[model samples]
Target: MFLTYKDLSELFPNSRGIRDINLPFHTISSFAEQNQPKGLFIPLSEESGELGKAIENGAIGAIWEEGKEIPKYTPNHFPIFITNDIVKGFKEMTKQYMKKIKTSETKNMDMTKFLFLEEKLLNENFKTYDIAVVEENLSLYIEQLSEERRG
Candidate 1:
């Protein structure tokens, strides 16, 4: 149930892509190096170097700010979503992902028993002890399956 570029397209209609819109991305990662299974890069700066780093590190695609110069290294067929407000667009995409999860999987789950979140969308740096550290770390990795946690 991973989200595809097509799913995000509905959220950002001003996007530009010359490739397949159905490419699946399971995580939303900011740091390029940590993505084991490809991720969607969220451009935090208008610098092409930053975007290029993410791409070179294996970002499947990115949400590019309108008017920002894309890196020359970017392949012509790469998917580049254009948005006037990067923050708003990023928020909308994650929010919709959560909504879809709630209406689908988490709708029937008992919250007390399973504290499931779309951990893929959240890359946390933990500072906890022993089992707590492992627990937190494992939680982040668990949702990259079967469409991930429903919110």
Candidate 2:
């Protein structure tokens, strides 16, 4: 999650593009702020100093661009993922992780069972209804699971 300055430059190539980067969840001030240990993104720029700051702030790991020398200030314990383009690598990694999460969520849920329940709830007019209710229910179920996991 941590993006070094060099990584950002190589991956995004445009400074303006870096500011527009979006992540799945809320981007908090510190990675440790989340309940679970998450990835950190630090643009390895001379000015920001987020890479060093993040390490001091409890970031577990960072993504560094390949062919770029690691900054002398980088700490030893913070693991780094060296890639050709840090931003692209971060996006791809996040996408793959999200897909895995979605896949796992639906793995044990029977589509037929869900359909049957929907039909029963909406009667024969189920075709006119959206799946918002189903999605909400699933979301709640996932939230409960996440809470349980955290506990």
Candidate 3:
């Protein structure tokens, strides 16, 4: 869940163009106020001083643009991800996470189908084929999402 600022930039190519963009992670002030201990914080600069301040303020890590010289003040203990564009990386990561979650849901559906089939067989009922039709519909929905993601 720790995304560097550089990765976030790649995911949001127009970030520089926009004056404000809502970050996926909550703001540090909000996190502090809520006493939330776990979340990612992406700083906008590779400057060591700025990054160090963010880390000191409870940032778990950072994502910085590749080729930009990291400031010497950055602590070695803080994690960093260097990327060509942060926004794109963030978007790609989001897509992958969504796909994994969908796949897990599909697996759960498969288990349910097995259970239904078993029950039908035990009752000597031949209507279990209906489960296949339902599964086909589910598959179609998943396929549509996949196609949209690809586009």
Highest-TM-score candidate: 1
What TM-score do all the candidates reach, one by one?
0.63, 0.41, 0.39
How does model 3 score by TM-score? Answer: 0.39
Clash count (model 1, backbone only): 0
Clashes of each: 0, 11, 18
- For each of the candidates, the C-alpha root-mean-square deviation to the true structure, in angstroms, is 10.2, 16.1, 16.8
Go through the candidates in order and give each one's C-alpha lDDT: 0.58, 0.40, 0.39
Which parts of model 3 are misplaced by more than 4 Å?
1-36, 44-49, 104-151
Model 2 lDDT tens row, 1-151? 2223343334444332123233222121222222212345434223224565555554545566678777677656545556765444644543443444455544443221111223223333322222345344434433443454456
lDDT of 2 at 120: 23
Off by over 4 Å in 2: 1-39, 44-48, 106-151
TM-score-superior candidate, 1 or 3: 1
- lDDT per residue for candidate 3 within 1-151, as digits (tens), equals 2223444444544322222223333322111112222234333222223554555555554556677676687666544556675444433544543443345534323211111122212333432424454344434433444454567
